[model samples]
Target: MVVERRSLIIDEREAASWIRDGMTIAIGGFINSSHPMAIVRQIIRRGVRDLTVIGPASGGLDLDLLIGAGCVRKLVTAYMGGEHYCPVAPMFRAAVERGELQVWECDEGMYYCALRAAAQRLPFTPWKAGIGTSFPDVNPEIKVFTDPIKGEPLLAVPAIRPDIALIYAAHADPYGNVQHIGTGFGDRALWRAADRTIVQVERIIPNEEVRKNPLATSLYGVDAIVRAPYGSHPFAAPGYYIEDAAHLREYVAAATAYAKHGDRGPFEAYLRKYVLEPETHADYLEVIGIKRLISLHEY
Candidate 1:
């Protein structure tokens, strides 16, 4: 029998307990966009090591935070970028440069492979992407071949079923129905393709409110819900404005300074503020007030 619809609202500690060592996790976010930074902070606090993190475009404060805290072991991303000069996801470049992190840089259709493979509960999804690009350089084994069901040139991608898919929403009902006004691509697919899904909502409301709109948040396939305030920031997605300019400017300067010279002190300082000191992303925001963040940077 199917379970009754209910949202599992949890504290950071309880929500973090859901994470285990060596689990393949997925984070939802874009360049300085709507990522589940709050939950990510707690995951970092737990210090779970040797985890594989996957996402579409994760170059943001969240990526650097996790990589700097040393929580990420492997990363699978379509791409990453920052609002400033260079990419924010230090994990990708650091891994390639330091030879410690394993990365799988997939192509566009690989997304099709990842989403479909997980959603279908299949071993893998075959496709025609990354045939002549750098993708094979990362995943040498994954390739295009004949489909077992049909004779055709097909590439197979291993099921990208994430142990946990952490996402953020502008609003959520008490029942865990989430509404995202903009850019919903792959949002629902990520959760439906994972073993468990956790949502951090900006506002909490009743099911009646959702029913008021035909485009309200959908209620199926949610496992957990968390109510948070201003969850987006240097991590806010497109629909939201940028969170902090001063910090972002500092980060860009730091990365560029490192590139120009051999000093990583400034970048490390930035890391200290967002990664080491704060227990949660919310705390980090408190450290840098919303108004100040705006004053310091631009969207």
Candidate 2:
């Protein structure tokens, strides 16, 4: 039987409520590109706990935002930029070291493996990855075993069936259906790997936009849609417009500082003022006043 998909539309704050403690979530992004930061910040401000974030080459302003708020319990990703193994955003490191968080070394096939496992309703997948290397040292959760298919030794990773998936798209409709001209990756992988999915789009365009693409998401796949401006903060880099270098630097500094303080209060303050309390990301930026944040680092 083909399962039917449900649909919903919600605002940013309402969308964030889908996140909760100890739930794994697949986030959309590729390093410092095309991230869903405004939503990430709100997830921080709202104080969801013990989150495991899986992304492509993550670790930057968006990551700092989550770690500083103590929301991230573990991170399965390719890289953590700006600090090695964690100096700026050391919470993930600390958590893992202290046995509070499980650090999983991730890579390209990670997206495919996780989704496949979930779609097939299986347990940790067994496949050879990072063999004869330190992946085992970094992530003990990946059990080394023989492949049922290949008839050889392989690594098995528990299918990453996240409780929810947080993603962003170029545009969406009132019914929560989405279309991406470009910049959307792992949408199907994330959706299939999670229990529910929430999207924050730059605009709510007409539903007909999907007809043009024909391969765009169906109403059944989306759980909620949120209209967000500058949704891909810091990382999106805005085509020709300026990026938020100043804010990103400040966030990195704050995360490193939080590592020393061992508290989430400061990062929460940053998110509340710059992301959650405001009606929109622009509203937060306006109230914060870009000119003021630029001088933040000099301090």
Candidate 3:
């Protein structure tokens, strides 16, 4: 078989353009950490609407920002909140409570299983997690059937196949091979499940360097790669920087103010300051300030 190689390097704006209206988009991260926030910001700035957003167990600023910007039509996830019980995701909670957003809730296992089914090209996966529970009651589409041999009912979860998936990585090559540090969470599965996968990396290393340690290259099937330092800002990228706790607190406060007082001022101001004003990811970093960013470095 002749190997085909494609140039995967792209800018943030181009990466955002890959997304269109009414697409099922999967974003990779756990809670607030390792999210592709830079690309998420670009997506918001472009004003893409009617997206069905999916993630693993939890999402923090990344998910909240998209929802707050009125980009999401539906959310399918296990949870959406801050890390370590810091604060509930104000925008997500507000939308759900007001019944403005359609939500499909599931446990982490069910969500992962659904993705796995999609990766394997299966119609659905069977699990016992939600059988005879309130999950089926809430999500009536989840079907249960009796196991032939075990004589026990198993829940059937439909495959979660996104039109595209966005993930952040510590390093990547021009060919789209990605290297992730720490627990990769559901990134690998998310990439495989999506029809297209885009990765935002801190930097691109030489292919030889990526080949030296094969174990670190856990990601495949990546469709595009963009070099994005501090791509996961406000969310920790292991070995690169610590989470910007102060900024996250500010975001939580802004969202809370908007939800409680019907004040869109703070949130809108945040959008202007972070997403709208910045022409590029470098511009966003400048707005974040060099001193603060330097302080966040793990080294």
Candidate 4:
């Protein structure tokens, strides 16, 4: 008897279709590194709306762009600022200040606890991190309960089960085995908390290559796999390229102008140039050009 090999490969557009309105989504990446920018841009282009977004522990423009594009109705995150590029993401700050976005405030520990609870299929996880903090004060969802064993106050971090997860990996086989070179930065936990996962990888390696170092396989049985070269463009991919600081500055400047002066001209112009007009991933990449991309490549 002969058996056919499994393949979960799909294109960026098809990957975006997996998401629906009002569903919660978990994005994987740290600050501006290894984000699935190609898939994100496609989702924006598809005009998906009313999304409840769960940003990474440390996120930047990836979340901001979604908010600015009017895709997110609610945001659950601990931080939404660029690490060193721009303290606060301009669009994210503007939306929150204008009362256009609903925020589910969580500290880092509380945020991770929620995901952990979901991953373990628990109702809620007991945490002491938010014991004396203002987290429960602002976000009533975090309930304060007495610990049964320790007889101490603890916060019940409700499970944050996402409908789907969008993650980036350095390599994945056709069978949906994902591998990463360096730290996955909470991506492992994030995917586990979701009902389904779509991974955007730089390369679709052979199954044999993935088995060569099985220990490096970060995730298995991914629902979908998209081969997106320079998928994290403008953001750094661990061992692939450095961030395009100049491009990031350009975006920050436009968004800041909109936030500071209500000048939508620059910000809208940016969306038109980068996100809206690009019909495909290749087109978006062409806008970045070869020379500039080559300059950012470290290896």
State the lDDT of candidate 3 residue by residue for 19-117, as single tens digits: 999999999988878998888999998999999999766666689889999999998888888865356788988888888888877888888878989
Model 4 spans > 4 angstroms off: none
Residues 121-240 of candidate 4: C-alpha lDDT, one tens digit per residue: 998999888788898989998999999898899999999999999999899999999998699999998989999999999999999998899999999998999999989988999889
* lDDT: worst 10-residue window of model 1: 83-92
Candidate 2 residue pairs that clash: 124-158, 125-156, 127-155
Q: Candidate 3: where is the Cα deviation over 4 Å?
A: 1-5
Best by TM-score: 4
What TM-score does candidate 2 get on C-alpha atoms? 0.78
Candidates' RMSD to native: 3.6, 5.5, 2.1, 1.0
The superposed Cα distance between candidate 4 and the true structure at residue 191, in angstroms, equals 1.3
Residue range 1-299, candidate 1, lDDT tens digits: 99786556776557777888899888775656678767787787788888888775444656655765678888777665564546444434655577767777676468657767888988887776555665655686476677778776666777778898888777777666778757755667677788888887767778788888847564345778877666665555444455555556676676555545657787677667766688765677788776765553333
Best by lDDT: 4
TM-score of each: 0.85, 0.78, 0.96, 0.98
lDDT values, one for every candidate:
0.69, 0.65, 0.87, 0.91
Lowest-sum lDDT 10-residue window in model 2? 235-244
* Segments in model 2 whose C-alpha atoms lie over 4 Å from true places: 1-7, 57-59, 82-100, 148-151, 216-220, 237-242, 258-272, 275-282, 288-299
Per-prediction backbone clash count: 10, 3, 0, 0
